[model samples]
Target: MAVRHRLIRTSPRSVWAVLADGTRYAEWVVGTASSRPVRGHWPELGSAIGFEVRLGPVSLSNETVVRRCEPGEALELEAKAGPLGTARISIELRPWGDQCLVLVDEHPLRGAGGTLHNVAVEALIQIRHRTMLARLAKICETEAAEAEQRRPLGQVVSPHPDEGGPRA
Candidate 1:
């Protein structure tokens, strides 16, 4: 099993927003070249997303199905990697002040992956999780910053525009 956590400088809502958009998975998930919703609605239980993983000229097709979901709190998935077998991935979100702490847990459930699982595999998964969480954090933080910049001014207008409050 591989377990890792990351502290994202954004609200859980923002992180969940990214997760809820299945098409965005490739942007944050390690090794996923592209992703698209294949069945039902992504992140919803039983819904699945198809993704292609490319390594140089070689490409492998895989699909991940949502096994469980708790809206902004948690998401559990079963990722099928053809003959390599399947793995269970669980993601949890916890509120830390105004920020979000994301935890990821994964383990091989069946197939060759499970049969061949060992310390080296666990280490590899740890590295993947570390990179994946960093990618997710970057996306969420950047999105939050962009959203802040785009937000309309509050009701209170500043007497001087240079003061940085809402312009009169």
Candidate 2:
């Protein structure tokens, strides 16, 4: 298993918003390009999104299906990458002060990936997770900042609606 965590300078709701948006998958998910919703509403249980993976001159279509979803909390997905096999990915968001602690856990579940899983694959996943988590953080932080900039100076918008307004 490859597990990594990042503390994003934004609310969990903010992080969830990014995860909930299927169109943003390629932005934060390493190596994927042009993500789009394919079946159902993304992030909902059983929903799926399709994306293209490019390896040099080869381009393949991969699909990720949501297996479980706890809004504003966690998302569990199964990513099918053609013959390379499927991988299980889990993302969890926990509120920390005014920010969000995001955790990502991934492992090969089936196909070539499962058969070839080893220390090298684990190491590569770790590196990919690092890049993926950083990208996620940057998106959440930048979006939060932009939202703040657009808000009236004298007003405060509660990023976490379930947690009430303003943080001391």
Candidate 3:
């Protein structure tokens, strides 16, 4: 198994918002050239997203299904990589001060990838996780900053509904 973590300078809710959007999969997921919802509602258990990977003249397609979800807390998925097999990916978010600490754990579950899993493959997964987490952090932080910029200087918007309305 390969596990990696990153500190996103934003709330877990902010990070979850990005993860919950199926269309945004390619934005932060490394190697995914394009993606779309293929079944059910994304981020919900049993929901799936179909994505394509382009490598110069070659293009390959695959799908990822949500196995478990805990709203803003956790999401576990099974990513099917054609004949190479499927992998289990688990993402967990923890509150850290005003930011969120995201942890990703991945391992091959079936197929050729599973049969060939070794140290080199683990290293590659680690590298991919590092870049993937960085992309996620950049997205969450950038969006949070942009949202703050759009609000009035003296205005305050509550992240939760029960907190009250946007106030100035």
Candidate 4:
């Protein structure tokens, strides 16, 4: 398994707001160039998103299904990448100080990826997870900042116990 964690300077609900938006899938997910809802309501178990991954001149279509969802807490997905088979990706959100600690756990479940799973593959996954988690944090922080800006300067918004202070 490839596991990684990131501290996002946003409340769990703020982080979840990004995750719950199906249209933002490509913005944070590594390698995904674009994403669209394919079936059902996104974030709901069994709902799916179709995404395209581009590598130079080649573009591949992949589909990911929501395997499990716990509002504001967790989401688990199964991503199918053609001959690469499928991978299980589980994301958990934990409240820490006023912020959200996001944990990602991923593993190859089937296909060539599963058969070839090894330490080298895990190392690559770790690298990818690092980038993905950073992107997610950036997106969440940016969105939260934008939302805060929309509010009046003196209007206080309740801070999440985990998020600490204002994000920079």
lDDT of 3 by residue, 49-138 (tens): 999999999999999999999999999999999999999999999989878999999999999999999999999999999999999999
Better of 3 and 4 by lDDT: 3
lDDT of 1 by residue, 1-168 (tens): 899999999889889999999999999999999999999988899999999999999999889999999999999999999998999999999989878999999999989999999999999999999999999999999998997777676655443435895653
Best by TM-score: 3
RMSD of each: 5.7, 2.1, 1.4, 3.8
Better of 1 and 3 by TM-score: 3
* Candidate that would win on lDDT: 3
The TM-score ranking, best first, is 3, 2, 4, 1
Please report how far candidate 3 places residue 159 from its true position, in Å. Answer: 6.7
TM-score of 3: 0.95
- Candidate 1 weakest lDDT stretch, 10 residues: 153-162
Model 1: runs farther than 4 Å from truth?
A: 155-168
Q: Native-vs-model 4 lDDT?
A: 0.92
Which residue runs does candidate 2 get wrong by more than 4 Å? 163-168
lDDT tens readout by residue for model 4, 43-157: 9999999999999999999899999999999999999999999999999999998899999999999899999999999999999999999999998999888998897767666
TM-score of each: 0.90, 0.94, 0.95, 0.92
Error at 165, model 3, angstroms: 5.7
* Model 1 CA lDDT for position 13: 82
Clash pairs for candidate 4: 96-162, 97-161, 97-162, 97-163, 98-161, 98-162, 98-163, 98-164, 99-162, 99-163
Off by over 4 Å in 4: 160-168
